[model samples]
Target chain A: MDAALKKNDKQLTVAEKTLIDTNLLKRISNGDQDAFSELYINYQPRLIKYCSRILKNDVALAADIVDEAMIEIWRSAGSFSGRSQPSTWIHSIARFRLIGYLRKNKELLQDESSEWLNFKDDALLPDEEIVLSERNRDLIKNIGKLSDKHKEVIELVYFRELSIKEIALMLDISENTVKTRMFYARNHLKNILSSLDLTDFG
Target chain B: MNKKQLKKRIPIEALKLLPWYATGWLSPQERGYIQKVLSQYPDFRSLLDAERKMINVVREDKSILDKSCLDATEIRLNKVLEQLSSTNEKNKKASKGVNQGVLVYLSNLVSSCSPKMQYAVIAAVTTVTIALSFAFVAPLLDENNVYYPATSGVKKSNNNLTTLLVGLNIEPTDPRLLKILDENNAKIDAIPSKSGMHHLTLSVKLNATQIKSLLKTLRDNKALFWFAGEEF
Candidate 1:
């Protein structure tokens, strides 16, 4: 698995990895609809994930935030500077949009823990249930069991790839608190994985 | 650097930062140090893989609706882009029209009169436009304008005191109608009627006796149909 992932990662040069988005933005500024489409296709899913993670997988709300952000991106594509990675810039934009969304709907975020209670259960397709390996499927099932605080840290750190500093600022917590939560999250995740199977921990 | 400094600088806690390393969020020197540590420490490679695997697993699980969301986003973004494009086009046309109209007005004003007459020109244009609009709408609103079709033919009549009954959709001017007036030397005129029907006219020289004969002929004429037993 490691070798396969390494092979995939090696296909893109560092320059290609970092500069392709910058180049896409440059093309977009010239009123290139194709470039805009390409960029939207790439960013939309990731932004949706980011927004939904906070809104606890309210996909409709997530989609709304993403679409609004995309409009703002299209209108201001010319103003993008390469001071930060494209993903970072986009994450910031999505973050700001989420902030606005939450400010408007304070009630939704109040019960974030309950928002995704049935999410993983519903996300499973019948074919995936048949075809996915039991271990990985069990991992997904177990991820849903973690507490909201631990799950939030794990998702923001490992899945979203947000820096601890950024996550701290977003959650209005200290950096040490973020790190402490990450440590507990990793330990709890390992415990969850170990509980799924015996041989790995042994 | 001293051996103590080198040992202190070695990145032991970098194992904990593997997720950030994978994300490329670390500074260049920190990344290099972490790389060096991982190269020397084979166990940490597995740790990195495990972190990477967890990231992939979580991302995969969270992206359950990626295709549907992407499609929704594409449709929405395209709509927004289309709206922006059309609005920009409309604004461009409107501004262009305004610029051209202002230029033409300025040129006409410069050529037509002194600066003192500019307000007069504008007032005249406004008044004429209002009058033209009123005239255009008045015909549509009036009842009088709805009538008055010269079904027989559209023509003016010069002979005065002409009377012709529009008797029940008959042939407009049958030969018998003129035969009744032929004894009086009736002159059929092509002049359009000012008030109403002028199907046939008799000269005054025909006098009352000829008129009586013409009336008798019209009353007994089989070519005419009398409705309600009235002398039409």
Candidate 2:
């Protein structure tokens, strides 16, 4: 489980959190500032991380993008038809903005620098676990080096835990394309990991 | 292929969905398909395990922003909130002006009439206004005025109690939910249905204003109640 899940365990189950998010969106539609604030607090960390990954780990720019997306979310909350999960709806808004930002600044998408490779060893682990964590960090660095198309599919699946259908809708691609990209992305990662002598990793 | 054959072999397209299946994020149909395959082909579990391992590694990378970026985000959010507040204020003001303008326009039109015509117009306006007011506002003040479930078809009976059908967001076992019910002088009349609908009975008869207040309280606690409506 991710940090968000861990946090939710202390307060709400996943189902409860989803219900609360839906209710918050309804309240936000009615000009409820408190509801909006609560939602912002809940989603800010998640959105910032998502946008950062897409924007070549530009955390500052990602924050600005998330803020822009949030304002849009506030204005458009009333029009949201509740057909999808609120998380999906919110992520779609952020993804739309992030894609638009990339369109205007194409160079940012092309810059695959190693500056995004920062990692911290925060947890105490056995020697084997330590080696695994080190290998994991390297894997993350390699993921950063993937092409934008391949990287996005991997990130959406492994990091965000979004359904393939949700990702296809967000990326405006066919589900087949999503699956193909995911396959190629995994193959690419596997090749790189093997090349790095990190064969213990899947 | 037969069903058994299909379960025995994993298609490339289905293999591509292994990551999501490992994450437990696939739709029920997809998940069921994958689960069926995994159950039949035990050795294929290795593929699923591999995907799970990769997921763990990816998630281990906590893509958290630095404190500086988080603080900046907070500042930006506050600015956006201020902008929204101003826009809301502007909308309220514009609506208020429109209302005032309509009243002023009507007053001027009535004033331009002759004295007899003006008196007749005034009498007519007053009669229409009063009739409209009674039509719109009488129910608001009526003691028996309460929300009715559209599907229930039950009307208010002559009693000192009202039933409210509520959908709870919190678990039914939560003590805080009981406390909320107690605060409203309500009790669970029926255990929650599978869909989470709870029938709560207000112990005392409440007037329209009280019901409105109670509904407002229930609606405001969005984290607790998904929905609340009286069963009159």
Candidate 3:
């Protein structure tokens, strides 16, 4: 079994996953259906969460967008220059698809704004896990309140786990600009979280 | 160094990097500086700790969806890819123009060449031992391996030397591809294999510079076919 398949180890390290994904992508380029299936299964959750965060409260649409993005991946598998990690490339596709989905459903998003913070729950999650999830939801709600540019940087850093250079590529900006945006985003997040703690809900 | 210099607080730029450092975004040099500052300044250490906790909080969404979402996604994906695969031949034609967006993969083979390396690459391409391959390095075969000054014609038979693992979806005889190959001094031989795939082999002798030029040429072209080999 692959290390990622071991019972107590559901998560693989970034390097391990990147190595595995890179090999799979190469195989996928050769019209390997099995390799494409493996990529879909591995990336399904992260991309779902990413789209969920970006579009906010649209799980069905998020799922569709991610599905569309995967198909795009299958078609574009040949052009993948090893410039970014496979995961980052996957996220970039999802991000573009998410933008289109968002534009298509802008009105629907505003209608669901109240329910945007309601994340799906799992029985397997513990009490501390529930509290953390709630905190994450609150934080993400505040993230939605940020300027679009600031929100993008923070989301890319925390959700996508992209580095400065990767973020630069995705945004078509410079690495220095990425750093500056990240600095402001973090500061804004700090203020928002602090303010959240002082509200009546706190 | 004086005691005051050693005891000075972390600078503002270093402080600004705390969040980036926590997120593993800093360059190695910046990371090292932040680590040194963290060791010396307890105040900055606490800020770094806060940043770590915040990032952890941001990343804490361990929510995996129910089986229903999975089923839905798989069903939809199958519907889409099945449609795509049925029309795969048609899609391959369109895919060439679709991926032509300005973003090229930022590989070191294209971007990091020093001026001297660039000069050497030009010298090599002009000299053309060009295997300009889609895969691995192979030796130049017989009198057939010739660089065209638009005068020397190519050997057309199975006589061309073959390097295995040239991967791209387009057929070897695509007009655009033939144009690209002719423009350069490279050729591809389409070998049918038992694997139900076009085991297209890029045929030529690879010198260092020709390999680099081939990479640049392939990258500069807006076509979607990608090769999976690492840089030579």
Cα deviation of A80 in candidate 2 (Å)? 3.0
lDDT of 1 at A171: 96
True contacts preserved, each candidate?
A: 0.12, 0.26, 0.12
| Ranking of models by TM-score | 2, 1, 3
Which TM-score does chain B of candidate 3 obtain? Answer: 0.25
Return the lDDT, model 1, position B182: 77
Q: List pairs with backbone clashes in candidate 1.
A: B155-B191, B155-B192, B156-B191, B156-B192, B157-B191, B157-B192
Compute the interface RMSD for candidate 2: 17.9
lDDT, candidate 2, equals 0.65
Candidate maximizing DockQ: 2
Stretches of candidate 2 exceeding 4 Å from the true structure: A1-12, A102-202, B1-75, B115-232
All DockQ scores: 0.05, 0.12, 0.07
lDDT of each: 0.56, 0.65, 0.56
Model 1, global lDDT: 0.56
lDDT by residue for model 1 (A94-192), tens? 655665565445444343422322122222332232223234323333333455787788778766778878998999999777766776566455544
Q: In candidate 1, which residue ranges exceed 4 Å CA deviation?
A: A1-14, A109-202, B1-77, B97-232
lDDT of each residue in A66-155, candidate 3, tens digit only: 788888787667666666667666766665565445434444334243132122223212322223334543433333345578777877
**TM-score of predicted chain B versus true chain B for each candidate:** 0.24, 0.35, 0.25
Worst 10-residue lDDT window, candidate 1 chain B: B223-232
Error of 2 at A43 (Å): 0.5
